[model samples]
Target: MVKNPLKIFMLINCLGMYDWSLSAKYFLNIYVFASTIQNSGSQRHMHFIKKTLNMEIFGCFALTEVSHGSNTKAIRTTAQYDPTTQEFIINSPDFEASKFWIGNMGKNATHAVVYAQLYTQGGQCHGLHSFVVQIRDPKTLLPMPGVMVGDIGRKLGQNGLDNGFTMFHNVRIPRENLLNRTGDVTPEGVYSTSFKDVRQRFGASLGTLSTGRVSIIGMSVVNLKLALSIAIRFSATRRQFGPNDDEEIPVLEYQMQQWRLIPYLAATYVLDHFSKTLFMDLVELQLGLLQNDKSIRQAELGREIHVLASAGKPLASWTAQQGAQECREACGGHGYLAMNRLGDIRNDNDPNCTYEGDNNVLLQQTSNYLLNCITDRHQDKVRIESPLESVNFLEDFKDILGQKFMISRVEDCMDSSVSLAAYKWLVCYLLRESFQKLNQERKSGSDDFEARNNCQLYKNLWATVLQGSKVLERPSWWREFSSYKPTVGSLKSKL
Candidate 1:
């Protein structure tokens, strides 16, 4: 390890941005790039150039295009091999298909890890794969031949970072440019991969979803913390109606205000706890993958972890948005200012719901994955470990759902012991609802894409509903709240 003090300080000082989305992206890229290089030789020079020198080389993963953001399989950018030159020719064939909305692509990127459909000899089209293409010379910020890149201009938020649209017209990249960890092709045009199953291939393509989900959870937690800190401090100081004519009371003293804010306080606390625990689960999953465990348990864990993170991110982002708005109202006029940070936080988080994968589209992946598990149970197949084992409601499937709210506290809404009960109701309800809607669309003679689009409305509705239920039943919130209690009793004895 290099014992440079200056680099240590730079790394230490990076956590200053409390809830900013761009800040989180900056941090993630830093950590990921470091891990990528220090731990492996796959992209060492790229990492060194980007981070070690403070050079602003924003190399975004160019997966999503203008025409299709979440739908990766539908992207049209083509990469054709030139056997004579030993290079690949990349192009966006039409207007609707250019790479769009990629961070670091606009003005700062010297290179991009672009994803495109690979067409080889005999015209066999391989699914999406990444290529590290040189966009600009690292020293000179000019575009390379056959590469077109520029910003998408101002966005809803995170405008400090330039996100660009890209078009590739006959761009030639050396044969070695491909990241071939999952799949590879030879000079003779024989394409092969370790994963023969297309579903597994697609899953490998989206393995990064774990990190994306983790970042969203962390970002949402930070946003919630900032909002709650502001609101809590402001609530304690702000005066409102009181029983006596001569006196004023703090906003927090009111039951309604307590109902609105304190529950969220409890919620924010819980989500923080949950995020940390889930991160540990992810760490284990990573270790399992690295160890080449490849047991049925490992695959099951990967799917479950993806489901948890996907389901959890939308929940946190939506909560943060609501919490920020409530915090703004609680702050009266001050929260409206951009400097107060609530509004900006809200705007930045808005894209989280739609990006990475549309929260709705992603939930279906989780539900589909989970429903497959349920089908396995129905078929009397032996099963591997599942996070749902923590929730007994899934086993019974009949007893607790629709079992009356019993009370109206936020705590009641998210009772940990019976939390899975709510989750069952939420999932079964949405699953059935989506099925019914999809069936209706098909019965009415709509095509597959049209039916899927129409079904998306229910998808959004059900995802939110399911997430809300999970929050109440899971122990994440209560555990988080418990940690904040005064531990003076135990500390005194130790002292």
Candidate 2:
């Protein structure tokens, strides 16, 4: 599985071109479900692996509840420990507690990895815990008793995949059904874990969360590429007004068209590389965790991976959103035609911004990680030693900020090195400014949450936007100029 990350991503990308709904369905069922089972430890879930791999059992992940989407802690579904029966009674107390928008749960999936608040026999709620719950009878193709499941109606797009909702009413399952790799209950109804800190355990339990975001990054790139390919090709072929009475020029010749499309074209290559690099990093982290290699470096690498996934997913998805819109507009009215496929691309890619994690909320995670890094630097707690060296520039933040953009001409501003340097400075400036705003908010009597909320305009938006732009812009500049060769009679080129 570690060796297959790139292959898996490429397959998803290819599948996305044919039909996004198909790719999304397979991605959720195979990638997300398999990742969860793998992370839950094979000792207990090997049977599940065998059944799923053999195609005898289909599964979905049930995490987001009707009342709780992003806030996993607030989900009200309960798995109460029944000590006498040695089972857990999974129940949804109210309508809001039902699991919503679960892929494949509407009609097909036989089981689900359900996340619910676990309560011990003593009435102690043990944060969020995952359990393998049977939602349907595989043989009869009917909903299991006490499991209310059905498809949620139409969506904006990707309608080929069934989005579903589920509610459990006094459903009983064996205690061993719990995904107990992170936390577990004793036969005597005691809750215990190797990790004492709840936050640490939460982090550990998030092993499967990053996989969806990583796949989304790759899928977004695929959508962007598809959009650009159509727009650029059509621009090159379609003709418009020109100087001569009988002559018409291809839209690609227009400066405005090139300016509009080329940057996204450049971004495609840049994000493609970034996504691949991130996929490899994730593969390494997954292997390390699977092997139980609990070194400090591994822990730091995990944090870095999480931060990158959070930031990169939003970056890639938003880029696709804007790029698809541009592609649609650049194609004139024809782009809106169903035959052109741009509208489908736009709608299919839109949900990515909100699904895995809302883009805005995800950006906050990145900003918080950045702020923590800055704090650690100032307090001399830890050196800025990112495994990917993404944050190493923070070490020279002062130097970077002091330097100003010195390009003399518009052409100079187009220079890849100049653009990259400017981007670095932009990120550094935002980081410093955001830190200041957050500190000021705290000083003005706001609590941590309120201060963080208040600083979102400066911290979250700037940090995520600038950092993501820098990531794409740097490689984009390199790929754009590095591969170009000038003809002898052409205008002077930077390369």
Error of 2 at 157 (Å): 0.6
Worst ten in a row by lDDT for model 1: 33-42
Query: How many angstroms is residue 329 displaced in model 1 relative to the true structure, after the best TM-score fit?
Result: 1.3
Could you give the C-alpha RMSD of every candidate to the true structure, in order shown?
8.0, 4.6
Expressed as tens digits, the lDDT of each residue in 105-133 for candidate 2 is 87788999999899997689988888999
Kindly report which residue stretches of model 1 are placed more than 4 angstroms away from their true locations once superposed: 1-25, 31-57, 291-293, 380-393, 398-460, 469-495
TM-score of 1: 0.80
User: Which candidate has the top score in lDDT?
Assistant: 2
Model 1 shows how many backbone clashes? 3
Give the alpha carbon lDDT tens digit for every residue of 1-495 in model 1.
Answer: 113423422332235244353564454345433322222223423444344336455456567888887778889999887677777888999867898887677887776667789888878888887777778776777888888888888888877667788899899897777666556778877787877688776665566667567667766777778778878887888898788988999987876566557767888887888776777776676666545555767766777778888888877877877887888887788768878777876787777777677776777776665555555555685342474343324554434344643443434434675555555666665555666677689899999779877776666666666677344333543444334342544323322
TM-score of each: 0.80, 0.91
